[model samples]
Target: MSTRTIQTSAYGGMNRKLRFNGKMKSREIIEWLREAKQERYYTILKFDEVILNSAIIAEVLDLLRISSRHGRVWERVSLEFCEGPVDLVVSSLVLMDCVRHLFLASDKIQDDLMDRLSTALRISTSLKSLWLLIPMTEVSATHLGSAMKYNRSIDKLSLSGSNWENSDDSDSDSDDDTNDGSKSLRPKLFGKQNAGNSPVENQMSPRDAAMSLALGLKYNDGIQSLDISCCDLPDEAMAPIIDGLVGHPYLEALNISRNRCRIQSVEALGRVVEDDDCLIRSLDLREQSPHDALEISPLSFALRQNRSLEALRISHNELVDSQVLELVDSFRGNASIKELDLEHNNITEKGIPDLTKYIKELPSLTKLLLGGNAIGEEGFNFLESLEDDDDSICTITEEDLRPAKPRSTKTAKTSKSTAAAAVSNNVSFLTGIAE
Candidate 1:
């Protein structure tokens, strides 16, 4: 007798027809998988916070085993586990041949599971995109790097929150040697580590994990887009990773935002952009450590020399007038840049003239984001001057011109006449704007 056909209700794409959320009956899921035909119509499957047990594990294994034997199966699969045997479930999925994309997000994953997943990645030939949002250990990162050395199919890798704090080992510093005497290298990422949780086995160290990832990436040639944002990476740890990506041929987009990186790490990233073979088109360096005054000359130097980068985000880096001037001056001859984000920086009227001049000269720069800065009335006048020329190619949005804070009454009154004059020239250019 022919088995009953499973008609899934969820739809994410043309082939995405299966979706399981929260708890599911083991027998029903098992029956559905067992009865599934060779001509499986569903290619995408997602499981969110599903409770797990032995029957679920056995059923999943049976389905994967059958699908594997039938050759490559499945296109994309995502699993967000809240509890239960994550290692077993994830490992089985990783080993599946011809699974094009795999995303696993969980906080319960342990080192042994990460090791298994890394081993599976080493021999896989079909997976192309991998997103592991699980908490990671240094040993796990080392294994992952080793796996990346042999794997060439994956081009997009996101390890966002991979190094997030584990409940079992939250407050402990993973790298004690970093704090021995060096003032430059931070012992741990701020707001990311606290010392109250129960100790866990084989805890992750950010420095060692970053070093291992760098070593692995140095050999991997297929990765193009990489995201390690919000990983709580410090300068000492982040620098080596930047160093590894210096001469990468295929790597293009990199996001290292919201880290504890200081100037040392920034300089290393500058070297990567300065490389003659660098193909990086977009770079993000936002929300770095605000307490430290980072010198941005290295990035300016690299920008002046490099021609491949198009989009740059250095917002929330506490750039003052001098640094902003330096950055604008570097854009004089370089034409590849199309968008720049200087939002939430410390730029004021002192640097607006140079910025206006540069934006005018570089017609290629179409978007200039300056929001969240205290550009006073005079600085607003500088931007208004550009708006007077109706033929100008660049257009700064009103949002881009908004000030970060309220203007002081003294300064507001002092520049009242200048502001009025600027408004008269261009009534539509950020009218009634104040810092």
Candidate 2:
């Protein structure tokens, strides 16, 4: 909109950089760069939801490209290609190493562009955050996997809106095993590479991409927050991600929701929760419903030992009343969990007794979500009772998250006077008895 819409201020940290965010034209951007003499600048410069064409994109990129080639640096700039000439966007960022935060989204994306972005990430040691909501298929996945090997600073990654239907023949609903059970239906990941060839010669499958990412994660310690939600990964691909959770200490948030994982793949998650080595605090396994408690047994058992998990979402898993009872029972000694989402399960009034028992005893539970089931009016009444019941010891975050206020000195003086008067009356009665 307005070329005068720029906001600027000084930010203090180890690196005291000037930060600015707003929409501006290419000419305005050039003006700001020319006026500013600082080496470190955090600029979020772009139009709001503007669907730009190739010419506009080229003009903007040309400005940025020319500035960078002339030794100008944008320390932490956030760039989003609204609608650009696919060809220019890649080249626009090639030597712009100062560009760290990136957000790319498009209806239709080209392969070479995807390859170029991957290549850029290989050298983006300054890149700390990247969100590719566009359909890059295996290209983004493999490059991201490979980046973990080289880049040390790029930690936050979001590959959301990835539909595995990147291929005309791609079907994620296929079974894990072939007819003889000796081979996997999905393409094998990283088979012994031919001596002179490379892994890129064959386009990486979704499974291979996942494995490559996870394999790189095994040796990596930089990535902490990973959101691979809705990235059409098959059951086989889901395995490496689970296995990658084995030894990572800095990984605090992991969301694998809506990936449609199988029992075998989820068993790996069980191992991760059970292992004391992994430091994941927030886990989202929603929509990957396990049929019975047996499917959830590993995590149920792991809960007894896990002290780091704070929020767990197992909603839409169709858990029976017995399963709910088992889940509550497993949380007996656990005090770290603040939110337990059991929404869309089969929990009913029959399981309310066990639920109430642990709700009072567990000492750390705050919010218990039990919506979306036929749990009936009776189950809700049970929850209502939990809220009103003063005897409930736990539910730490619910009613008694903070300590009681201290008694006033004036009240203490009043209590002392009242106690003296009662003692004097008692002495009179004792004196009469003595007489």
Candidate 3:
């Protein structure tokens, strides 16, 4: 006995949108296909991780073909933790004139199945978004990169959590929820080498995968948003990908968070932001390493010259007070950035004065997320006072407002003097930036 869920949404009394989830049976699928042929409704079908044989695949394909031949089309299809058989089903579905979005999550992808998927990607003209949250291999990465070079309809692509080195002997069974099925369950981003006959072929370094992807992205013109976070790509690998995205026509968002990108990657990213023709709006560098004053200098300098980037996220990257001050001073006359996320860093009362001054100067900055930091009471009070204005700051977390730990005498005296001046001068700062 299998459970199934079907949700329907009627739009403007014309066509219905139907979403089907859970493990479906053959008889039930046949009945649903018969009923769907008579109705005008779009379909979003999601398959649970069940043993899908050839018969199930044929019936599902027939159902999609019938719906597409009618006025109704399948909009999205998802397969969670399934294997090559499911991959073949979705690959066949992509060749249809339906399925704008496809999500496939698996523990392992064979070379033949990846070849089929890559062929479908190249031939599918209607697919808009493709997410392959699986343990990717070098062959699969090369195949997908080659496909993207010829693909023209895909707008959003995410290949996150492909840092898995080997898929052999790895268990795919899990009780975890697949709500946000893009990420993997692994704790570390490092790849593990497993013993095998073809050991070298079984291992796909994150950097190699990224380099293959860069080759494909270099020629792709239609991709708008790219997310390769959690892939453990260092500077050498990420530099090539950043070069591929240098002058993209429609690219607006890039998320490279949780990697090991160092000075070279940061400098390359700074060049991308500094380009006058750069149209990128959102840059997410969350949880990247070594964000001291020197490592962050390249980006800080680029921010002073960049006018296209709107949202910058550097959260949980171990930023200290001096780095925060450098960032604030860099954004003095910038007009584009609206959201700045500095949460979960080492910024405290010492950095709050410069932040307060910068906030007063940059009118475009509306939302500031400083939660998870030890900003202490003084920092909290100053930021809270600014909240009197509408839509000025995000809700400060309890950690941001909590009392600071005791500092050394000289540091405490300096922080206290800076904070008192900032607090007392808040009157003029508020007045000067008043509407």
lDDT of 3 at 168: 29
Top TM-score: which candidate number? 1
TM per candidate comes to 0.78, 0.66, 0.77
Candidate 3 lDDT tens digits, 1-435: 223333222211233333333455556645554565566543556664545666666667777777567635566666754433775677777777577777665544445667887888887888887766555666777888899999998988876544434332433323233233322211222222323224433456656876887898988888888877655566788887887787777888898866667788888888888777688999888766634322777888887877788898887677888888788778778888888888877888877877787777877888888887788899877776667745556546522211221211111111222222222322211121111
For every candidate, C-alpha RMSD to the true structure in Å: 12.3, 20.5, 12.3
Give the per-residue lDDT digits (tens) of candidate 2, residues 299-401: 6766777777888877756678777777677778887877777776777778876787777766787777766667567766676667754543223222210
Please name the candidate that would achieve the greatest lDDT relative to the true structure. 1
Clashing residue pairs for model 3: none
Each prediction's whole-model lDDT (CA): 0.66, 0.54, 0.64
Q: What is the total number of backbone clashes in candidate 1? A: 3
